[model samples]
Target: MPNQSTNGPSGRPKPECDPIKDEKMGLMREVGGQAVWSLSSCKPGFGVDQLRDNCLETYWQSDGPQPHLVNIQFRRKTTIQDVCIYADYKLDESYTPNRISVRAGNHFHDLQEVELMDLSEPNGWVVIPLKDSNDSPIRAFLIQIAVLSNHQNGRDTHIRQIKVHSPVQNSIVSVLDFPINFTTVQMAQHSTIR
Candidate 1:
């Protein structure tokens, strides 16, 4: 919900790569098995833009449990001191709040307790922070959105675009200034002759 955008040194807007249509989301797409969806699959006359209602739902398999991964890349023109990712999905009474996981570098976090507020309108979106000291330097991040259902009939969930925003980058300096310990060097130097 917070404005993740920040100004760059030159005051130019940070470059953004929002999925315009279903095709664009494909470039950043990852799926489990054969499940898929796109803008073309949507009803005619619906605009394929960065909005909540443009995404389409594909096949819903009742058997075999599996999770999917969706990844997207964009330019960080500024320092990006911090960032938040948002996602929108549809849900019903039978729907259970799925566990959404976010990974930035080696760090992984989870978002839980998600529920649907309105059925007529698209469900609310969740925001997760992507900044952690232990997290690796994130060139890009990957989000795994999934839900587990016990119902005999599986339901397909429609997903809108995932948005990324942050301050722009001005320089190419290392975000962290710290020495990394080399395990090989330590072992060789401290080796004991037996």
Candidate 2:
């Protein structure tokens, strides 16, 4: 057998990746489109549509003052585990967000700050957890992303993409779906190891 060590076959230590983060992207479902996306101020042709178009070339560019905002409002209460934002420091330079704030509540008027983060120099998708210290996902009707500042103190900012994710709920499996509804005892007797 080949090496079964932490270094694997390459003999280089594997980069550590948060399994929860990987699950958020791989197993979870994207529910951002279920909400209404709004922006504080955006340049024409570079608005919410571009920010969520799932493309890297297009981006949402803020046109107004500091503290650019992107708001997500749901019709009903939603569970959000994390928010992913794609940014390129090399490409956007001064327009790259340096500080970000996440807020959530029932509405805009009663929004409460959830998390504040400072990004040094990001060049790819940055995932921010919406969970509390107890590791519970945030449940709210409104979720907001505020760009407090940008690199090099740039007034406007460019955000290539944004995604809101929630853990995938396992669908209930029933042994009674067949034409002959199976009883509990019948299921137990018929069950086999695959």
Candidate 3:
């Protein structure tokens, strides 16, 4: 008789984890919903809601001229480590963003460009890490996504989704890294003699 078991000698199934499919697979905290979102222009039905609904079929369609903007503002300053944007060139074609610029600052008036990306017919989620010259995460209260151009010179743009992530320190690792504050006498006092 042929054996049909697929498990290893340990009798444990293999763990399956795909980074692309898992939205929060890394040590990062998603903070997109905590901020206020605004768009430069949008169609009646296609707006920020569609972009954040986590549905690939739905997208935020801009109706204005070139350089469409999506502004995200937070009440308090926060560290921004990465930005993920979903775009389908096959579905949206010319509406897909070809050039993107990310800006960060305390406010709109003082916004400075942090990263510039040029995509060539991207079809899935593109993650752009925001880092300073010193390789540290950017700290700001405002973040903006600017679509400078679209595929095939399209004026408007279609963004399926956007996610902002901040670096997270593992609790266990942080606890282990903490300095030992108690002296030997203090440690002994806490130990049970019985």
Candidate 4:
């Protein structure tokens, strides 16, 4: 049998924790539907699924070297107002991107720099507003990592979360609205939409 105490089981002090690590992980709280970030490529474990996994403790890390691009194709053409980026800058300042360019268009060939961000701060959520084009919201968006802040200690860039805020145009759906004629099986036979 072992002796026990109120402070601890053996009256021993608990080991200290890394505040920076703790601060970097599991830091944001926004309860809603699953995240909507859709990307093309990332590391195996750090894949697109983690980008919107509802947990800030995990992040999607880009693979390979510089000039990493994340292509986002929303299910439908979304009228993007702005985006919220949650990155733990204090923990990984070097690997964090210093300059990011926003490209918005219906097709890949049409992508052009709509907005540029020279991000400086870190460790929390930063809302990057999508540049309104001629007073019109962006239909679809892509994030181009223009410049990466070379971190002496890290190589891969870390992105905790990227949330798109597309305001609801109107919620007044007619009761007469009917479902599409095509079924799941039919859609699957035609193409892999999902």
TM-score, every prediction: 0.33, 0.78, 0.81, 0.61
Q: Candidate 1 versus the native: TM-score?
A: 0.33
Per-residue lDDT tens digits for candidate 1, residues 1-194, read 22222323376544443433322544323121121222222333322333233343322222224333333323221222222223233333232224434333311243222111112222343333344345522333322233322222334333344444343334566524444454797665544435
Sort by lDDT, best first: what order?
Answer: 2, 3, 4, 1
Give the clash count for model 4: 2
Model 1 sits at a Cα RMSD from the real structure of 15.0
Task: Give the Cα error of residue 185 in candidate 2, in Å.
Answer: 10
Q: In candidate 1, where is summed lDDT lowest over 10 consecutive residues? A: 113-122
Clash pairs (backbone) in predicted model 4 = 89-123, 94-151
Q: What is the number of backbone collisions in each predicted candidate, taken in the order shown?
A: 5, 0, 0, 2
How do the candidates rank by TM-score, highest first? 3, 2, 4, 1
Q: For model 1, what is the alpha-carbon lDDT of residue 79? A: 20
> Per-residue alpha-carbon lDDT of model 4 for 69-147, expressed as tens digits?
6666655666665556667778667667655566777667877776665555455665555556475555663433333
lDDT of 1 at 102: 38
Whose TM-score is higher: candidate 1's or candidate 3's?
3
Q: Which sections of candidate 3 miss by over 4 Å?
A: 1-26, 172-187, 191-194
Stronger candidate by TM-score (2 vs 3): 3
* Tens digits of lDDT, candidate 2, 82-122: 88888899999999999888898999899988877777677
lDDT of 2 at 84: 81
